[model samples]
Target: MPQHHDPGTADAPEGQASKSGFRPTAVAAVELGVVGQSVGVTVPGASESVQVTGISLDSRTVERGDLYVALPGAARHGADFARTALEAGAVAVLTDDAGARLLALGSDIAVPVLVVAEPRSVVGRLSRLIYRSQDADLPGPSMFGVTGTNGKTTTTYFINALLQAMGKKTGLIGTIEILAGGDPIPSLLTTPESTDVHALLALMRERGLDAASMEVSSHAVSFRRVDGVVFDVVGFTNLTQDHLDLHGTMEEYYRTKAELFTAERARAAVVTVDDEWGRRLAAQTELPVTTLATIQPGSGPEADPAGPAGADWTVTDSKPRGLGTEFTLRGRNGTELRVHTGLPGAFNVSNAALALAMVLAGGADPAEVQAALDSKDPFTVAVPGRMQLVSTRPAAVVDFAHNTDALARALAAVRSPEPASKVIVVFGATGQRDQGKRPSMGATAARLADVVIVSDDDPHDEDAAAIRAEVLVGATDAKEAEQLDCKIMEVYPRDAAIREAVNLAAPEDTILIAGRGHEVWQEVKGVNLALDDRVELRNALTARGFTVLQDDGIES
Candidate 1:
């Protein structure tokens, strides 16, 4: 959904089903008669009949006894793959009139065809029908969803960790990976396609999980990947400039995000009022809404004492603890809890707070969520790449900050330790995505960090140097306009960029390598090479005379 990266980058292959073989129970065409009636499609050839065991959007993954969905796509028609799906033993084909017209032109398509009006919109419901029957039917876990420009992954991870702390088997879906009450599985998309989402839910049900948390991206919302999901409690962590390429405008982006707060999408919602977008969303949502704010004097100068936000839950106290921070959340009903997070910075505090509220809203035990938030316990929720420290002497950290807002926040969080600690940041924009953010990121980095290293992020096909030049324009503007003392340097390969940052920093300074979080592969011209930032940072630090340890709990 986030414009697929390569085929096998981080996600499992399409045909590589779960060990349990993700196919749900078989359903007859008569069973899905309701789906057809809703869309005015009739299944021909009365096999009454054929039972479909699986539903696949990708023709490549369709197995015998499976029904393949054929729909129009952005680049090409899914009907083009109908022959492949038929060859893969698919029982029948489901498509709209457009795809049916394409099938009519082909002479070899002899399988049953069921037409639908909008395949994308009904596919989620169809997936649920193929997998789950009802919310109360199986041992399925209650779901929680989080959406925003940033913090979706961290917040979902936080919710998953808390659910586990409460002694519930948890399933997690995020940008980095997916955990279906089993081991961590590489995530193909931030929010997977609807068919995968329903399949994963069924898989979690089979594994005896009690709860699951999913990160819902705006793209997933606009593209109907999450059309039929019913989240127990959805969360909104501040939205900023992002994904304008997909939504076309900021208003459209906000509307797409707002779609999740409706009763159809979620049972209830928790919103952070740290930004105007969050405030507007909270005010507009019709479902049961709970507001969480880790900061006072919210995004605007206004605060409503009797409204859903600022009136429901507010942070009344805060203090920086050793290696972490502590804060207090108060409910409008006079409920209060003292919380501590092993993570640093106020943004993480907001994340933890929002996570706590959403889980609580989803019927988790309050005592357990609060206990999990206690700083004295073993740290259970650590995001893989957000402000992760690789070297202590120079305080070199790696973050997934590709946008202006995220980059500025990462620099601010790193600099929060001490005023005397200077900052050196290394990052570059991805090729052909939100090109407008490039110069904005440059200006933000120059304004916040003492040194900016402009380098490659993932130059898909565009000339890498040309993209760098556009970013340099903003860096030059920031340097000249503010008369800042920051020095700008251009570097090739991101690995060399890390080395440059290490070379520029001293024992007292901070070095931040931004963009590309837990991603292990780097996209260049269609090829995804191994280029993890953590590995590169540790290698650069070790090469620059710093101790580096292997991931296996041992020093290399």
Candidate 2:
């Protein structure tokens, strides 16, 4: 049977607390009436003394003294779960009229019911009011938010690394993990829900972390996940085709990302003017904007000089440094800072450049930024799945390049310059996403890679075979139309595809496992299958006598 999961909501962990078990413990309970009135919603039958110390959107994550917000979901109303929220110690419920009626039908739900005209719209304001997330009196961490189709995760990781290099304690929120000066908490979405986001920010402040960096995805912006949080600096990586399933068009997607740069959300901006979208966003944003340009091999030709030519900061004198690259950040004001990243791929150079530029935008002294770069080499830090290296022999690597442009760039970045060395790429498009990109991804692999292997990537209730066939169509068409010399094959159950790539590879060849990086699970027909690409690549490489790198205490 096909398991139907809610597309609108993330598959959040089912518990009262996240893995970190960190929530605002010192919160002063706010009255239910006061909370409702703060968001312009009315609490009719609720007592004025009914107090809530926390806010939660998912019933399963409800804690004691929580205002469980029952927003309307696509497949089912959250009101349907109000009884469970009550059972999980939710003291009150905030929902729309439909939810109020549903609660009325469920007589056992006797808690306060605060009705709102639009429950989702008011959730952020209500959460802020209850949590004091952005109260001017409290000292909060300086927040940085990054958005785009491809580089959001890597850029945010770079931002956190640079901040740490500058001697500031840091927290990170992104697709891979969440950090709050403690152990890493695995993340489900690029950004968490507004309620959890506020709680995490408060937790960072309580822990005395000086700064935090977050990946602001298009879905996060569209779904109100980042509602109450404002950033000290916001960055725009180049926007490309993605999330069309949600935004319906490239224009809408660009608009959704641009929303994060408003004065309300961020104080300053760092725009990477490598593409027209970044140029448009830099011009259109009301916040004070700082433009950056990186002319890198992975980014292809410069965008006609309309974007990067007249930028505030430009990456100049870039040269290859082993597997990585070394570049100079030349400011228009004659300030030059040397930058180097051990991470491979020209795109990583761009990501590194953006990170350095953003730290300066966030009020870090330029000399301090330079000192950090010189001392720590922060941009060279290993970002878990963004171009993570697994083996020296065969040069096995994994990355999160699901979109066409990203795939093209990743393939270009990993292709060896050695004339005899081949690029074997194992990749597949995600199911239930923007289906239009699958063929483009296929053609991209066929063009750049010596061997194109189409495999499964999170089929998620969609037919895996059908998804593979779509990708195969593009690869096959490209091979024939362009008479490309790439060998194309279809493989199933991703692990086998990975093993096949290893079996086909030579010691000098490069194996790129794209589309799933750092992600440990593959969802198929609604069940999460434990599948880590790095682990698989490592095990396969070691079995074939390839020397693998040590990771997470696992000796090579």
Candidate 3:
């Protein structure tokens, strides 16, 4: 129900704009009776002339001529706020029998109440109908969705950049921000609710955008946030242990991610065969899948030139190009592409390759894609907070590496080859998340970094000291058990930890600030504190006489 409004961008209908900046300029209105019949529901005593122009789940954000969906929540039923929704100009209400009964207990509301068996299940389908996003007569943008435990945000940004490189107007939805070819809107989730998703798609069509890239998280697939939306092409970056707190296990997490590659959700898919999960997904999905094998630095013997047999495309011939890497993408029939990414790490090479392959799999002309690669260098476009280089003297970098695998990759990517150079890391596990990953993250830091400073991340409704202690447990255990030669320390007040890292660094050392990238807020006890790692790191480095680069700009 929190809206980030940017006026003068589009001519929206009166009261059509809502939270998450989804404002369609027009709505092809549908009658309430037709909507009920479409979703196999009947509205008792509903007027045939009543029309629905929009849909909303939150009562506070219901627009004029909108259908308010009152789904039951864990704490309170949405029907309890029916009066608030009706007063906000909702034309009709859609709820289940329990919601209807809850409505009956209150003062009689005159709006139409359409009763359904499961209101949440039909919210997506109904939103699509009302928004007219996928109509045969009027098509929406070419949708591209990327899903994985890692690299989703960067891959989506890469996809958008590639589309723009090919002279296409692009929109993006991800953990960073929502861009509808205009000013960027702050995002609250990886994927917004079904209503906002459909509405934003319609807005993209209205603005004449050609393509849109989205980051589809496992939570979005499980929560029905992307139910009605189907992608022209879907992409899979390698999966690892993540979001186990939500899915309960690694198998369940994989199962939730597999939902995005279904025949109903996506037309085609490009799977990265860097791990067993990606290979299994490529083999199991019914969608036409193109498998890719990107050989990074530490992939061991399995990352050969003839990467996984039957791989439709393979990335090989990688060489260092300044701070980035130049790699060749070899495909079937002796076809190849010369790719370059002006970003650090071999993982970025994988991200760039996946972006290019996904664009090609979506039916872009190969010659045009190559031309874009030559002219635009789309893969080098800066993605906020993904290996963002803040300063050069100590080589301070900020990355969104929250999990154990990501932490190891980030630490490895920033290590200096000089024997005297040390790696200083400042990180901590997020509270109210998978607590099981705390020790592993600490262990990874201890094994990879020369100095590990465990600090507080978002400690939402949890003790910050307790969270830090758990991480220190892993760091201390790894240091003692493996006899690792790393200095481990516990620090508090995250900005102080950043300053500490900069204070302990020589010009030859590299400072890696892991976790909480691009996020400007830290939640503790349900209150958001202003905290941007890039900003803090820049200020700290500047205070220490180190040169800082502009936002996400890399000079190598």
Candidate 4:
């Protein structure tokens, strides 16, 4: 049996009170009425007096005196679990008016129900109220949010490393791990739910951090996972075709990402005008916008010149080297700084510049930014799955380039150097995602790689073979075009595919394993199994008696 409490007093027993921490603050007062009115449900329990300590979507995570939000999903209405949540010690339930009516008619639920229209929309405000109250007592570190279709993880890593180089205590939340100082915490999602997000921010606030960099995914933006929180700087790397399955269209996907910049709370915006979408976002956003670009030598018209003319910061004279990259950053007031990044790829130059712009916008010195870039080897802080080199003989690189645009970039980066060497790639499309991109990905891989091996990548209840067939369409097209003598192999098992690719590689060959960077688990038929691409590559290489080099010191 669960203990019931009056609206105003603490009801959980002894040690549980410390574990639960359910004391409600002033945000709850205003949120209750706003949510109640929005949903057309009269505030049933004490509105002015009632307090909710935390918000949760899962009934299993509900603690004593917490508010459980019952949202509707594709499979079922979350309100069905209201009774279970009450039994698990939930103080109240926030649901739609229709859901409340159903619950009222179904059973006599002792817990108070607050019904609102479009509960998901109002959830952001409610969560903001509940969590933002703690902002005064525990102000966040200078938080930075990075978004876009590609280069998010790499850009995030560079920013974290640069901040650390400038002698600031930093925390990171991205595709790889969550860091509080030097300790790494495993991540379950690229961007966690709003409640978890606020809780993590609260933890960082307690850790005396000076800065924090987080990856804001499209899903996070669309679902309001980052709602109610303020960002010191929000950056856009580039946008491409991905996650259309959830957003329904490219315009909607772009709009969902635009939410972060349009957000009234973002203090500054940094965008890469290398892509057209990025250029448009920079032009429309009202916040202080800084544009960056990495134009290859002798390229056509530069992507977005409007920002360089009107905006406060821009990057120019971009040149790539084998050791690192060199560029000139021009500020709005005619300030120029020669910047050298110890990271590969012309794309990385853009990522580094974005980080520099973010740090500068946050009041860090331009000289300090340059000093950070020069102080350490930029490659030292390489993200685990992004261009992560696992073998030396064939020089295999594992990256999370899942989409056509990102795939093209990764392949280009790999083939840029050693033009004579063959680029062999192993990749697969994700299940239940934008199926339109499948043939495009296949075509890209077939055109780029000397040997293309298609394998499983998070089938997730979708037919793995059918996904491969779609990818093969592009590969078939590439082969039919007579681009090169390309070999197409279908390996169902990812590990076996990796082994086969490595075994077939020569000293001059570069094998790129794409589609699952930094992820440790593979979801097949809804079950998450331990499967790391880097680990498997390393083990296979060692088993075959290959001496892997410390790092490939390749210049961009």
Off by over 4 Å in 2: 1-8, 12-22, 44-46, 296-299, 305-307, 552-556
Worst 10 residues of 3 by lDDT: 4-13
lDDT score at residue 456, model 2, on the 0-100 scale: 97
Off by over 4 Å in 3: 1-20, 44-46, 296-298, 301-307, 551-556
RMSD of 2: 2.7
Error of 4 at 32 (Å): 6.6
TM-score of each: 0.91, 0.95, 0.94, 0.87
Candidate with more favorable, higher TM-score: 2 or 3: 2
> lDDT tens digits, residues 1-556, model 4?
4543321111222223213222122222334544455446677546634565677776655765567888776655677777777877777788887678768887787767876677777666666666562366656689899999988887888788878888888988877777867567656568766765665666676667889998999988877777777898999988889999999899999988888997575988988776678878999998888776555333533354433344556667877765357888788788777777655566767777787777887788877777766776453476778777766557778888999988887887777366578888889999988999999999888877888999989898999999998898789887888655889989879999988888887777888999997777787886777788887777777777787755633221
Roughly what TM-score does model 1 have, to 2 decimal places? Answer: 0.91
How many residue pairs clash in model 3?
0
- Cα lDDT computed for each candidate against the true fold: 0.77, 0.85, 0.87, 0.74
**Residues 349-409, candidate 3, lDDT per residue (tens digit)?**
8899999999999889888989999999988888888998887778989999999988988
Clashing pairs in 2: none
Model 1, range 1-556, lDDT digits (tens) per residue? Answer: 1222212113343444433234334433324454455556765556435676667788766777767898777666888788877888887888888989989998768777887777777888887777662357565788899998988888888888777777788988888878887777777678777777887887887777899899999988887778778998999987778888788788989999999999988899999877768888988999999887766763322333433344477776878786567778788778787877776556777787888888778876666666765633423356788766676677777789888888887887788366577899999989978888889999988998888999999888888998898888899898999998888999988888888888877778888889987767787887777788888888788877875534412112
Scored by Cα lDDT, where does model 1 land?
0.77
Would you list the rank order by TM-score, best first?
2, 3, 1, 4
Backbone clash pairs for candidate 4 read 39-116, 39-117, 321-555, 322-555, 443-474
- Provide the lowest-lDDT 10-residue window in model 4: 6-15
Candidate 2: lDDT of 284?
Answer: 96
